[model samples]
Target: RYWPRFPRPKTVLTVKEVPTVDAAFVLQSVAGLAAKAALRGGNRDMVWYPIGHPAYLRWHEEMLRQTRANEQVLPDVWAVVEHFRRAGIVKGYVLFRKDAGDRRLHQRGAYDPSANVATVLAARLGAVMVSEDIEHEARARGLQRLADARGLTEEQCYEHWAAQCSDSVLALVDPRVPHCRAEAIALDAFVLATHGPLLERALARIRPDSPILGWGAGDEFQLTEPVSRWALWQSATNWCLNLPVLSTEQVGSTFPASSIRARQRSLWDLTWEDGVHYTSFLMTDGDNVQWLMGDFQFGAQRSWWNSPVRGKFPMGWGACLADLAQLCPYALRNLIRTASPRDDRVLMGGGYYYPDLFGKSRNSLEPLRLHARRIRGYLRLTGTSLLHMNAAKWDSPEAIRAYTVFAEEIPELQAILMVQYAPYTAGKGRVLWVRRRDGTELPVISARFAIWAHSPFPDDGPPAEIAAKLNAEPRLAEPATSDAENRSQPAEVPGFSWVTVHCWSWFKNAPDDAAAGAEETDQATAAASGAKRGLEPVAWCVRRLDPHVRVVTPTELALLMNLRLRPEQTLRRAVAELHLRLRTAQPARRSAARGFLDKAREALVKRNYRQAFLAGKNAARVLGVMP
Candidate 1:
């Protein structure tokens, strides 16, 4: 036997001292750096060690063959065998009976059961199977392969795992590791940033079973989420106290009740004023397109609280909150038609006028991002995407600047700057520059004209008149010009030339007589104009406008603006360059357009102007423009 000399006398050394072992090899095989660090940190559950890759089938076959034949093995091969034997990797799999449980176990390897078992046991033992350098790429590949095989997308896989497994589950990325312990690390960061510990704890202390204080029409109201029926069955229930139980006829005759008692106190005591606040909470359920066109009606009040003679609905967040509860599901589903991590397309957009006035500042980037995230989650769950325009509350230059910064920071969201009212527009919506006190101007992202009409209220003129005015009068403002841009411009610009009008009266509660009056108006308009029954006045009027006057949504408006506006003749220059490239292209490069060019040349030579124009038009169309 080979023996190594020790520092002390050999006679004094035991038989164990005769064999030489490298300290580095022993430290690596027995107690790795990651393992030693874990031990030092007192976290025994984290027992991961970077050992080796899954060995090829041939490597194991040769090793087993050598062992069975009683042939000598290399030192490195002997070390691997000795390490696995000592670690009980082979024994652990046999004890667990993994192969017997899963038919797909053999897919990973064609080697003997023990060889495959070693790799499986190492994985089960929390070993780091691959180097950290390729971890991200490896996770991506794993997700892709699973998605390809199962016919699911990578996002779907992540969502499924998040719902069924853990919110922090990285299973789509790291199948070999099973589940990661650091899954909720990103969520924790978000929670800390948004809802701090103090607020979280304060909200947590409120008993869920306590009676919820809510105000709205009871029987007439339609909750947005369908699970409201289940919510009533739970202990933390919401009771809408003001049900307009009286019929429209009885609403007038009944005396106003004095006060109500609930949870050991009069409801009047909680109020600052002796008179109760009148709030409007309307819910419209139907096709959102019809709703957008002002076809939907507000729910019947049939109660004294919202009696048109005694009180008017408050126009603020209290009213908006009620409406939001009803329209949330619809807005979340229909408003945002598409979403993407990188898509800059403007599919749709709309502005909320009162979000910041009530407190939740949509003018800031964080709130917008948070709102986007909420919609993003909903869209991803349903496998959809969309774009929206969230406007600031105030219509001042300061508000515009704040919102512009928000939009600039998050261009992917494609936010369009807006304000509730501006002196220049006087609340009649207009996309004009507001000059600040400091003489700086801010560009508002709405159309130059807006028609705000409340139905049954009569502030906005009849739909026919408004529609005719819009078609005949509204036009996009002339493009901003610099000295260098002296080229000719179109005399009449075409497309959506005004902000989408607000027909809020379409959501007003009305008396039976008033409802009949509206019906009469509808019938009269239909008879005179031959418009379709049940169409909103606005929709009817728009249909009557000149066919060339387009009715575009806010998102479509943004797309058109970006498309038509040339920043210092950027679009013009690009088009010119494309034409130049076409004209000067080599024969082989222009071969695709050679036939059109030849036809146009022949027609010009023959003095056939019409034929020449036709061929030229075709060639221009092919070049992505018209002559």
Candidate 2:
């Protein structure tokens, strides 16, 4: 609901003085999500309202001019509306003011609750309009002071009959109003949100040429210390790709404290004075979990808003809404019934989009398998994810024995080791590792091997219910991670010179039987000895591999993913391929293996695969292609 007081703009085309927005990009974003959502097979229906055009206004004026005029328009309008209504869809419209309150939330300004106008617009338009009454407050106090900045006022003066209110057949809203579209899009259904901040922001990062609907990302946005302005772009995406908003009642408990991001610590309600808490920022939505991430299902995986950054920052509009639309319903359902839907945290739900997703490869330090689309990252199996375990386990006799053996043998056996005794939960787990034909371990990792958690929290993810029943299976864990669990990396990773990840205190814990043992139980005795055992600067061997087969850089991976690179991508992969061959000979004869690989790249250019593959094969004695 826009404050009726703001003045109007002549046209988006004419508003060149202000920054001319990417109109095509914006509309493309909305359409991208809508097309995929509509095509998704669901019992749901979708409703779309095309505004900002003279045709719509002419139609509106014709209907409003005469009581009977509405009857004529009703037939065509009802045809479209009835199609959705028959399919059980309840939808609404959002109009662009060309002039909206840009005064950031939490500014001192005029009372902008155009509740009457919202209700009236709903009555006239036959839908419920989202009232911008809430935007007056944000992050802190003395808010709305910049009211005139973005053109917000007490009343939305741009529209006719500005003060009427009604609850009609549709829902009217403005994206600027924080939870306006939240309520609308949160409903479990198919929808097309257009002409609002929701659409604008979602499409902000998209290229106008080609865009896919509902894609995915890990929770990098949430875990990072400081929030990036582009991070808000996630809010736009979550609304566009996720299922309906969750009601507080469904959670039965408060939002988990795991939800509150350190970057959001200073965020508060926007009330200018007491007793005027018109808009609420219940930051600790049940347990302090961030707001949009509360059981929200937005993309192919958890929202990237909650994961760690990789080589290069990922793109927003590049999200595959179409891929998400095609995922199993359980992918969305997992957020509620299964363990933590930690798909990058900010967004939740979504199964593997492809049928042949191989598996994960953790760097052996932590066991959580953080994934984004086809690429998987670290597990939240560190101390913070456990909410227990101090900084002393690495040097314990038990820790030394387990890890040294793990490093040498686990990779040897193609197993991703998961400790069973973290303070967060109970049970031990064992999931074998997956290695590519190239002998590199996959990054999807699991910690189901550890067994000392005292409660039902998933030490390993929910058991492979569907998979084992159908095929001998393996599934990785996705835990709600904490900033505390974030460990520091040693100066070097053991095997790979360029690879490194932070090792945390929670890596290993006492066995259940040992917890009560006299020797291990003596904390005072062990802390001192634990330090001498060589755990002070916890050792780490890590690798931040590009999830793609050959790409070493995230920029290249993002491009491959955007291009829909699939399993076959490996066939055309452009990495340095090495070739070597050797044959045993009689004692007197000498034998040797020769090798060749792609020449080093120059400047900023990536390696050329076609040239490199041929180069490597030339060195092989048996030149016949294996495939």
Residue 538 in candidate 1, Cα distance off native in Å: 3.3
Question: Where is model 2 poorest over a 10-residue stretch in terms of lDDT?
Answer: 276-285
lDDT of 1 by residue, 416-469 (tens): 433232211133333444333333332345323323332332223344544444
lDDT of 2: 0.22
How would you encode candidate 2's per-residue C-alpha lDDT over 496-599 as one tens digit per residue?
Answer: 11011111112222222332211112324433354111111111001111221121121222222211212122212322222222233222221211323223
**Model 2 segments beyond 4 Å from truth?**
1-45, 48-79, 86-369, 372-374, 377-627
Q: Which prediction has the highest lDDT against the true structure?
A: 1
The estimated TM-scores of all candidates read: 0.31, 0.23
With candidate 2 superimposed using the best TM-score fit, by how many Å does residue 569's alpha carbon deviate from the native? 23
Span of 10 residues, lowest total lDDT, candidate 1: 1-10
